[model samples]
Target: MQKAVQLEVYGRVQGVGFRWMTKLVADKLGIKGTVANQADGSVKIIAIGESATLQQFIGAVKASPSPSGHVTKLIQTELADVSLCRKFSVVG
Candidate 1:
């Protein structure tokens, strides 16, 4: 089944290549979405993909993108009727 989710990731996520890593993982998992940095020093990810693949993507993201980065918390919200994109991107 296909699904969509909006995730607000907190802790040491900014300025640490978290968005880039998210994009890489999303792409590898054949997921499409966007990752952006929030002014509150958090990373926001909107992903759409297979139910199982999305879970895997979330796990990979929680692992922290870079050694210098740490994922203190991850808040995920299931989204309905979200705009679907063709690829994953690191947006501002």
Candidate 2:
């Protein structure tokens, strides 16, 4: 079954190619959603895909962040409603 998740990644995530890297990972994993920078200096990612794939993607994001990015805290929540997106992209 397809699942959706909202991820709030904290720490030095902005201005460090985090969004770009997230896009790349999402595309590679065949996931669809949007990644954006939050006003609270965190990165927010809404991803939709198979449960296993989403887990892998989230693992990647936490285990391997952008070169200059350091993910200090990661908050994940399963979204009950899925918003299907055409493709994964970086959003404002």
Each candidate: how many clashes?
Answer: 0, 0
Q: Please report the candidate that would top lDDT against the real structure.
A: 2
Residues 1-92 of candidate 1: C-alpha lDDT, one tens digit per residue: 88999999999999887888778788889999999999999999999998999899999889986667899999999999545787899899
| Model 2: colliding residue pairs | none
Residue 21 accuracy (lDDT) in model 2: 90
**lDDT accuracy of residue 79 in candidate 2:** 92
TM-score of 2: 0.94
In model 2, the Cα lDDT at residue 20 comes to 95
Give the range of the ten consecutive residues with the poorest summed lDDT in model 1: 81-90
- Candidate 1 differs from the real structure by a C-alpha RMSD in angstroms, to one decimal, of 1.1
Please state the error at residue 14 of candidate 1 in Å: 0.7
lDDT of 2 at 24: 93
